[model samples]
Target chain A: MSAAPPSPAPRAAVDGETSRRRGLGWLLLVPGMLWLAVFFLFPTIQLFFTSLYDPSGSYEQGYTMTWHVMNYVDAVTDTWNLFVRSFAYAGIATVVCLALSYPLAYAIAFKAGRWKNFLLVLVIAPFFTSFLLRTLAWRTILSDQGPVTSFLQTIAVLPDDGRLLATPVAVIAGLVYNFMPFMTLPLYASLDKVDHRLIEAAGDLYSSPIAGFRRVTFPLSLPGVVSGTLLTFIPACGDYINAELLGTPKQYMVGNRIQSAFLTEHNYPLAASLSLILMAVVVVMVVLYIRRAGTEDLV
Target chain B: MTGSLASRERATAAVPPPPARRPAGRWLADHLVLLLGILVLVYMFVPIGYIFALSFNQPSGRGATAEFESFTWSNWGSVCEPEGLCESLKLSFAVSLTATVLATLLGTLMAFALVRHSFRGRSASNLLIFLPMATPEVVMGSSLLAMFVSLGFDGVLGFVTIVIAHVMFCLSFVVVTVKARLVGMDARLEQAAMDLYANEWQTFRLVTLPLAMPGIVAAALLSFTLSFDDFIVTNFTAGQSVTFPLYVYGAKLKDFPPQLFVVGSAMFLVSFAVVIAAELWRRRRSTWSR
Candidate 1:
């Protein structure tokens, strides 16, 4: 698995079959492409248009295509705090996930030896259960009378009345717990390819182990770090389940707001605008991050 | 210390020798990540443990059992005791099945096309495939809902809308998984079949399909799990429909039944068994071939 054969070899061999294969290829591609274009792309365009609909018009009253750009401006103004808080919470969770996952990934990549596959499976095992159920369990774990909070209080890590359940800390913890696998898998994939000999060579050249890791190992693993952060951060930013289940309205992020707006309040324009803004921001961050990571094969 | 010293000596003396034992500190450092990794793994399973343990608990009062009143085998015996739970579970199964089949069929074809044949707009198609995966669930859900509302399907949101949403999101994942398998396949197998006086259809049926079966199956499983587990996208388009997760969420508001925990536990165990069996079978196959 470590050294996959390059993809171009078979392409070169099949280059002569173009005329017949091309028609087959197009035929094969049509159904999926048409589905995506109709459902995904067309919906996205509708969403954009919906974002610009007249905010005063109710769903029953029928929204007009006024191209009301202030919906974007008003979305930013109204939910700017929530938007900023979303990115902030997701950013911190990404960092925390990185901190927790990097060592684990490194261990599995280099040290697990015979148990590598088992450990990797273990990493993904928790995900088989519903994420919502898992978050709900965290509510029990972090509840006022729960063991975790009680232990924290006993250890003086918390004030006697201080609780984790309804705070940003809980929300962030949920995000970290939920997205850790995303961070670890890519890190392991990249770290698995790091040659042990290079670290040994660094040691042999009189560099200390820590220095060797800092200068060599970490740099070699930067691609994983970049991809892992992006993967963790992007979904984390849009996640509302954690906030909804584990936190109060005070800790609610943009997702919670957008969800309520669309589903409960029937505020289509606001929800649409918020959705588009979040997508725009996420795309920008991901592209900038991938570019900085200097990888062209991210897809 | 001694291992490093010996390596240092060898480095300076330009002579290779048997490696020395690592120092205690280095050994600790080497194991530290493993220990930490184990701890992190344990942390991940805490909630799962809660789910499993709570499944057997007899809650004294209603409103989502936080404390275990007593241990009982009743929840497992009557897993569908909760009203609407079984119905929601059945709905989830139906929707996920429909979505998985549609997504897998469409995606596998696209995967073959992308991997085996060059096409115009290939890069654009790739980007199109990736857009859904990159976009957040909230955004995707809202967009689909917006599209449905605009098309006057708002009143008719239910099973059909849920399946459409599930298929749309699951398609990209299926394509990616199957495409990886197709790309990694040895073209020689198919070529050799053709060389052996086999027609194109015969070559595909005999060689290509068999080799790609694992990936297709994997993609199907992934699609099924994703659709079954989906809540956000379904919540938007489902309207009055209740999938399993939606049932659980609604139960959270009214009465968090221990039976829900049973369902969660069962889902986990079933999927876990499938994965483990697949892994063991794969290992056995490799050894047998060798």
Candidate 2:
């Protein structure tokens, strides 16, 4: 490719063409950027502004922007338990998803020699069905008289009268089930990119297979682990569907609080404040995680 | 996808000692991960199997149960018997279609700009794209609703608001997917077109656009599914407008008909078939080209 003689004129011409193309790039970027600015960035700023509004106003009467930032204090104090529980549930679900997905992704990336695509399709096929319907199915499967509970009871895992429905266990289980694919796909993507020779080199260095996996493969797959956990944890924290469908009020997350504050209770300031807090925490966590993972180009 | 079993076996043959003297413990260790993977797959499908079985179940008087009662095809026959069910489904389809088209068109343009040209603030634009995907749906939904209310569009929250919200979230995925394709594209093709004296428009239309179509199509499909299956963001923004998920939520509170399961199962089957067909077509196309 570099065998041709270096020509100054053509090189200068190429530079001029690229610079001209740069001018046209803004035209192409404007449409999408403008849309995102109006709907995404602007709305986020609006949410922050809304968070500082007077909390005493009703939804119909409208909120007044009095710069009363105490709404954040009030919102946090009011739903502090729910906030903690939400992160706890999400964190546990993320860990569980990682544990379950790592092996499955590894199998597809390494061991599913001829059936890799078929196995990957199987992993994603269940997601084609409605997520809400799938969660609802969990409700039935974990109901008091369901097979899961009955089997648990038979094995003495649960007392005869103990039930799975309306429990934190059920809510967490729903979350793990729902976010499994999110974790698996990213892990598979990174694991599949791993060069087989690197692991072989580690093996030749007198490392056991497990040692090679830990020292070489696991480090290589960290990007996937980081992104997968981020993807799973962020959404899981804000998810109210599992809590609403599977668990009782006690299992309600920050999402449920935000939802009811906005829709059911009509407390705009509270909801807005809560939403802002969730966004801020997620952004901080994501930035810290990406920096620690040493991957700047997440997208 | 390319490595055959024989190649994999050969690859491992170079790594391991001869099988004649290999320890049984090492063999079990080698296969344990695959076994665990199969178990996880079965675990994922358990609820799906339950959902499929319940689709054929005769739930006692519209109250959905997990129990597999007598097998009946009534749910399949009258899938739309539930009031407002089909209406909700239609609303979801309409919203997903509109969101997909708008998001795909705008996102493809952004992808081309990011990949094919150099510009200041390129990294900043990339950050903006990642922000939406990173933000939780609840936050995105509430923030959009807050913006709308502040702008006095509170009462007008229905189809338009839902579509807007869907497009906002779907944009990031579209841009990322199409940008990947654009970035991985061969620049030599466009260079060759220019060498042949093809104008920029002609070159783009004939070479670049065609190469990016599969990515754009995949992104559109992904956006459609995300929009259709969305419940979290839609829930906050959709005022008095019930999508399929919202309808399902309502049914959960009241009585869930077996027909809901039928709809879900049918959706699964249709998507599965489409995916299979796409894979087969891709395989055929690659073979033909080769």
Q: lDDT by residue for model 2 over B243-267, one digit each (tens)?
A: 9999988888788788889999999
Which candidate ranks first by DockQ, i.e. highest? 1
> Could you tell me the TM-score of chain B in model 2?
0.89
Lowest lDDT 10-residue stretch of candidate 1 chain B = B16-25
For candidate 2, give the lDDT of residue B155.
Answer: 88
Off by over 4 Å in 2: A1-16, B1-26
Q: Assess each model's interface with DockQ, reporting 2 decimals per model.
A: 0.47, 0.44
The residue pairs found clashing in candidate 2 are: none
Interface RMSD of 1: 4.3
Instruction: Tell me the spans in candidate 1 whose CA falls farther than 4 Å from its real position.
Output: A1-16, A197-200, A203-207, B1-25
| Candidate closest to the true structure, highest TM-score | 2
Error of 1 at B95 (Å): 1.5
